[model samples]
Target: MTRFPSQTPHGEISEVFSDVFFVTGSVDMMPGFRISRSMTILRDGDILTLISPVRLSEAGLKGLDVLGRVENIVKLGSYHLGAHNGLDNPFYVDRYGAKLWALAGMEHKGGLSTDHILKAGGDMPTRDLSLFVYESSKMPEAMFVLNREDGVVIAADSLQNWSEVDEFFSEAAANAMTKGGFIRPANIGPEWKRHCAPAPAEFEKVSKLPFRHLLPSHGTPLLNTAKTDLVQTFSHQFS
Candidate 1:
């Protein structure tokens, strides 16, 4: 078993909406820069469901304990399931990669694997949560909709909203991301488009979803006017 790197301390948890919380962490993506990573926590009744969870320290867990018991852990897409810390609950993922897990090597490091495979338009066990799979991308990705206040769309790498490069980025990484169109607010991630090659029609369908808040794994959350912003962003990229 490959020993994973120790969990680094992510910043304080901030509320994104009434029942949604977000935490920012750092990931070594670009050679010299530590890219920003966002994780979403949703409160349902007395249970707390984590979406694309980053490794939280003991203090972080205690902070989360105040919200509710961490009952369900979900990986929205193939790329964001690396922080599973041996929780016995079933881990969820879309059924796009059966033969080969996209990031199995990383999964091994975290001792986590997907046990529950969600399908497009399928119902997740969690109440008021629905999953939609994106078929056009070369890599299988899914976007989840939470029917909380004003509705929220929890996405993975498929959708990003980097208003500006955060301080975590090195100058080189910031410049490259800015030139590649990944630093703009309410825009598609450049790396996602270049690597996933998502189809325009798929985005067109996503644009129709009834969501007002966009909580993504890679960037800032758009609290209001999320639908309009996403439609315009998709139109600019696909139209």
Candidate 2:
């Protein structure tokens, strides 16, 4: 039952029913776009997978109080970990961003618990969890899938959410998915296509999952046909 702001180390929770939920926090990254992101609240029996950490401001955290004692906090990638509040679970990451996550901690506080590598095969969410980590065509991108009954799949930088982007980007540059926010193949999302390079094999592995929808950290989530769009997005990414 802890709370964070949309731009600070705060969180907000909203259940979309059927155990599928959404939690968002506000943030103040830098120049433009005062962002507000939500983490998909997923629960598989006892294991809770918080999708993405939303930026939370001090006042924002005070407003949207969230309650969820997550058994684990699974970070999608290194840059994505900025949303991490203070959960003491085993930190996990795909290949590309683990070192950065670790360095960020070392340079700032001290360090984090050893991070688990999200490799193929072991990357699948399995047993109703349906977790899938694609070594994206962009960076060391990692995504999640929780199955039909579970009703949620947390997409990291793979989905370019224009709806949300419009709010962040000025009216002139809204569709700048390739510029800033999530998975921007063109030049969006602020993430360069380097460092932890994308692994096509990884994306293929995740492409064959049965997810009902996708909930991304940046932009708007692919609510209904998230699985399809997710697969297509990656397909075109490598194609």
Q: What stretches of model 1 exceed 4 Å from their correct place?
A: 80-111
Clashing pairs in 1: none
- Model 1 Cα displacement at 156 (Å)? 0.4
Q: State the lDDT of candidate 2 residue by residue for 1-239, as single tens digits.
A: 13322234434455665666665544444444345445665666654445554433445334323333343445565545343432222222221122212211211112445344455446333245544554354334555656564366566544444343433433334434334444332212345234346556765665566666566665555566655665766666678
Worst 10 residues of 2 by lDDT: 100-109
lDDT of 1 by residue, 1-239 (tens): 11444455478889877778999766665357566777888888877777776766669768887987665666666544223322212222111111112221223223445555667555464678777777767766788888776778988788888898886677887887788787888877676677778788888888777789999887888888888998988877776
Compare the candidates by lDDT and give the number of the best one: 1
Instruction: List per-prediction Cα lDDT, in the order shown.
Output: 0.68, 0.46
TM-score of each: 0.82, 0.60
Query: Cα miss at 106, model 1 (Å)?
Result: 12
Off by over 4 Å in 2: 1-12, 31-33, 44-49, 55-68, 81-110, 115-127, 135-141, 164-195
- What TM-score does candidate 2 get on C-alpha atoms? 0.60
Write down the RMSD of candidate 1 (Cα, Å). Answer: 5.6
Give the lowest summed-lDDT range of ten residues in model 1.
93-102
lDDT of 1 at 61: 66
